[model samples]
Target: KAVALQKLTYLSSLHFAPVASHPLAFPAIELIASPQLPHRRLAYLAASLSLHPASLSLLPLATHQLHKDLSPSTSSAANHHVTALALQLLASPAAAAAPDLPVHLAHDLVPHLSRGSPRAIAAAARVIAASPSAAVPVLFKPLAACLASPDPRASAAAAAAFCELSAPPADAAPFLPLAPDLYNLLTTSRSNWALIKVLKVFARLAPLESRLAARIVDPVCQLLARSAAMSLTFECIRTVLTALPAHDAAVRLAIGKAKEFLAAEDDPNLRYLGLLALGMLGPAYASTLHECRGVIAQSLGDADSNICREALHLMMGLIDDSNVTDIAGMLVSHASKSDPEFANDILGAVLSACGRNVYELVSDFDWYVSLLTDMGRNLHCAQGDEIGRQLVDVGLRVQDARPELVHSSRTLLIDPALLGNHLLCPVLSAAAWVSGEYVNFTKDPVELVEALLQPRISLLPMSVRAVYIQAVLKVITFCCNLYVERLSDSSKEVSVALNGLSMDQTVSGGSDAPIGSSNGQITVPRMMEKDPFSLKSVVHMIN
Candidate 1:
């Protein structure tokens, strides 16, 4: 027997290793057949460690030995240990491979749930918890009785098992009657572990039944208020918020506790949890959350990215017409301060919020335009692409609502400093498109025309360059059409202004004047000296 024990230990160690053969099963069975309790316990332990789903042939022999050891004739100590080992084995991959094993064990284990020994009851409850859902009805009554057991360990185990069995919609009906009793346990139980288990069961049941959820809100809030354990507090908060309606007094109590957690707790993880709870509650309790806006915004700068992200999302949800500017500014500040890796995601969230809320939040279109221009100048690559699109979209919407705002946006986009910021390619591209599409809206057509041909236009990507080319052609064509109309009326001012336009001198005189000449003039071909759409000039400029 001692030799068998040594061999078992050695084989168990190698169970997970790549081995061609397993030789420990027969010896383990031989040890179990021994009349000695010690040998039987070791044999069961060895079998659990060495047996796996792949060892299908030896499963029945091991199951038979476990069944015999669980008989009433077995000693109490041996019976408890054997039952524990049986529960452990049932959870093993080998037992899972045997389709009928759990059903058989559930039948054998149901009687042990009412046993006087706490260990026996705990072990039995664990086995029941692991049993298939089909066995829940059979074991429900006995496990429910164990919920009131004197032993905290057994009660916790029973609560866990009951939660698992009661998870299905059809099976949940049986637990309705136990709601008050579960609440009683949550409030009166001294053991945090037991309360946590009960709270989990409550969380699952509350969403399905409104009355039960409503009833437990006070008790869950009480748990959150008094508990110092962060894990228990978090679980209680989740249970209360998830199960109870947002307007319930109990939910307010829970949110209050979460606020306390956010302020008092220095741990980033706990603060993160607090922020998450508040985030879920924010939309329903916007007024209540207003006080914590500073606290939530502070988390955006948290050293931990997860906390920052959670805070950002929560802040985004809190945005309304009243707070859009403040929230948007905070997001932009954080984006600028954050690592480049996270900046894009933060900016993307900002743009999304602005797009969805712009009509309601933005009363001052100028301020909105300036915000986009700043974001565009600061952003680059993919981040710039999204911001630019949002800028164009917001600009067009503003233009639609108030046509007068088009000149303001055009002025901002035409600033030499802004046009030179290559990072603002999308913004520039959007501006170019807008200028072309809304050419008649420009207050000073000549200035708009000249600003389109910045010296560094060639530095733009091919796509944006194409947009610039289209914009310039549209503006010049519009100008030429206006010039022709003026000539037909013989307006001398129109002729003089057209001649003063430096583009005419460069083309008419055929001078190779440098672009952006000494007098800050744009050197382009004269309007009548060369065809605006000539292939030769287009190729020359493109080159």
Candidate 2:
């Protein structure tokens, strides 16, 4: 019978699901009624492996036998192994999914948990959690009591269960009373795994109670200091970063440990995790994150994509009104050098950071406008739509930015090479719009008109072509108006101003300077110029 049960178990493992036609399915279910304990346990295993959730109801006989073995009056129940087999069967995911399992077996399950049966604790916790109305009143006390159990097995199992229970999406507030017991475990337990679980629970709980952070800080720090285990150290680092920031001493220790994680040159995962831990620090810890800039920047070019991504996230987090220009320059340069996928990710991150909250971090519109044009010009650049929107958006929202935006727009408009790239079309369209909207800002409008009408613009979508045509009309209108305004004086000067304009407008654009000094002196910078478009007018570009 044992040999036959083993064969059945082997067959069950072959198929993820069994049909009614399978040879082993019904026989495995019948074997659950076997008198021999080994036969019963193996039969349960076969049935569990073979059966699908929908067919769980076929287990009425198996369920009845399980109840019999679990009953205290039964001679088998007195045998710990027999009781463990019954608990294992009852706790199996297939059985636990059954709506009636908890209803029929929960009363029997609670005692094993109360007595600190290690296996029973994990399985029963799972079963209790699955119940629609968790038998919280009947089950929680025993479960929490297991934390205080003298046996390490019971304590570890209980801590793991509570860690899961108190995790996010499951409110930890209800488990607050368990904190005292968890604290005891934290202070005394030598088991690294158990301590990690307890730390998880405390991490969530600390945010809920102001005083809890004070209680757990010292022990977590001691663990951080004494433990050689990377996992435990990371958990402590996370607890500090997430919930115990007020402890300056602990936070500094965590940051020091995180830098050690970054220092692991051969292990990409540790480096990635190090960046993740550091990223969790709030604005107050910006200096610590900034101090790791050299290591983080090096990570951007690492062979591992995960480390690169984390590095990019931390880099974006470091930006503000003060360093946005320099950081934006570094990212744009890096994007140009990366493969297509990571390049686009870098571009997207920078665009999001600078553009977040209506360019709140942007202090110099000139520099930002230049950065936008530089990003649009990358060969692998696929972020055209957003770049286009930001260009037009900045022009509309920032009055002082119109001149720089116009210069940037003219830079894009005149690029015959860029007009061929479908990816650059959105940027071109935005440029045309900006050039048209703020034609007065251009160094020269006549040259702007000729560039807008460049032949390669035929490669543009009809929508973008429409934009080019509109920009051409705007430039013409501006020239006619400016010319007429000048005609009242000297048509020759107007013609000379129009003639110097560079019809082959330069694609180079970007600047961090304001358009004009406080004394109203103009300071034109790269990527765009301040001139009206005509050969001589455009030819004499602003410096």
Candidate 3:
């Protein structure tokens, strides 16, 4: 049977002669409808016919007949198969020829799908979503019921349908009233994936549905304020953050309040996401800088890497050079007593801020050195190998800018195990050679060199290995270039000192002392390193 089907397929392809432009070149409908046929042949026939839009209108009729042929009392497997076929038909672009499906066909299927089976409704929703623009209104009531349905599948389908419908500016009105219901479900339900789908729908619809944003902000804000469960609150936070950019001032104000709530919450993920939102809100609410400053500082102490990463993102957007000194001071003070985890948070935030102001802050060698020294110290002492490596990467970048800071952070470079952490190693290597110079002169000379020659070098793949090699050689060459450029200058001694470090390989490896390794501990910096140039100079000479 399969052989015969394959031959038939070949014959059909051949029948459609070159440049004829005729669509019905084969007997597809008769072969597919043949009952003695194998299901595989039927599936192939369907796929072949799906290339033409005209063949799509025949699908619902065929599918409905298939359903009728099977007794409902039979097991649901057959019903599922037929439904899947219907969904596949609807998802195909070829179905566009019959986009305006008859209302009765859809209405009759709604009751069957609504009776607690999520799969069926999801399939039905796809069909409704694929219908023509004029057919959307006809599908709305059933679509809305799917959203409120207890079945998670139906909820997801409804959300997808809503997202599709809201793509056009004119179709957003019908979705406004559904926002509150979605917000409520997101907060009260255990189904996070469903909420994510719904939030996507809201994001698509919210631009033109300001009234929906206005109506739901209060409740969404309250949910974010109180929910400790990150998964449950994820969409609520994202929706509130996305809505903050709306043209309405009321929506922006609501987001400000939500930002305050996020700052108070201890969840790192929420804090991170919230901080990112606040960054976007910066220009809109510059007057609230003092209030926002505190939130950003608190987020810098979050435990999660991504959360801290987000906090750093927010800080960059919130504070510029005129405000940099104060913001940097706040970060230093907040992270002073913070444990390793908290220090990691601060490091991520600082790195994020650096990306925004690399040109401005990179030149402040002293300050950059001190920050790297602090982060590297924590990285060496802390148990968070992951965070430690990240800090080390950033520390390397600081070293690249101000070799003087290397004395303090240099000890962190040689830990082979630290280099083994794939996530942070590449980042660290990139930072080291970003200036296209070797880290030849610093407080600890061998730190950068050993980082380059570590035994684990062979374990890395060609791509990453190439990256490390290129970055290291570039930094070395860059240092050499800098030396050549400034050799004739009177301040050459200071430049030489800044680029030179002790060659002693005294430290066998990174310090084992646990600084911020504790899962629950949070600490702040007690003091700032005062001799940035000396530390950086030692690292440059060593590398």
Which candidate's lDDT is highest? 2
Give the range where candidate 1 is weakest over 10 consecutive residues by summed lDDT: 534-543
lDDT, candidate 3, 15-34, per-residue tens? 75211123332333334344
* Per-prediction TM-score to the true structure, in the order listed: 0.70, 0.79, 0.42
Top model number, TM-score: 2
The C-alpha stretches of model 1 lying farther than 4 A from their native spots are 1-73, 76-83, 92-100, 116-133, 164-172, 204-225, 244-253, 280-284, 357-366, 394-428, 440-461, 491-543
Q: Candidate 1 — what's its lDDT?
A: 0.66
C-alpha lDDT score of every prediction, in listed order: 0.66, 0.79, 0.52
Identify the runs in model 2 with alpha carbons over 4 angstroms from their true place. 1-31, 34-62, 72-86, 89-96, 132-134, 209-211, 444-450, 480-485, 488-543
Q: Among all windows of ten consecutive residues in candidate 2, which has the lowest summed lDDT?
A: 500-509
| lDDT, residue 343, model 1 | 74
TM-score quality measure for candidate 2: 0.79
Candidate 1 residue-wise lDDT, 1-543, digit = tens: 546566657755666641114465667666767767677667766665655455656666666766765565656775667666666665554444454556666666665666634444544444555554655667667767877777777777767766655665535665777776687778778888888888878877777787777677777777777778888988887877776755377787778778877886468887888898886673567776687888998888888999888988888888887878888887777777778767777778877777764456677666666666556655432467776676667656656532443465476556766655666777778877877777767656555655677676777788987887798788767766655664567565444435545333332234433344355443433443354333223323333
* Distance from true location, Cα of 267 in model 3, Å: 11
Candidate ranking under lDDT, highest first, comes to: 2, 1, 3
* lDDT per residue (tens digit) for residues 142-206 in model 2: 88899999999899999998887777788888999999999999999999999999999999999
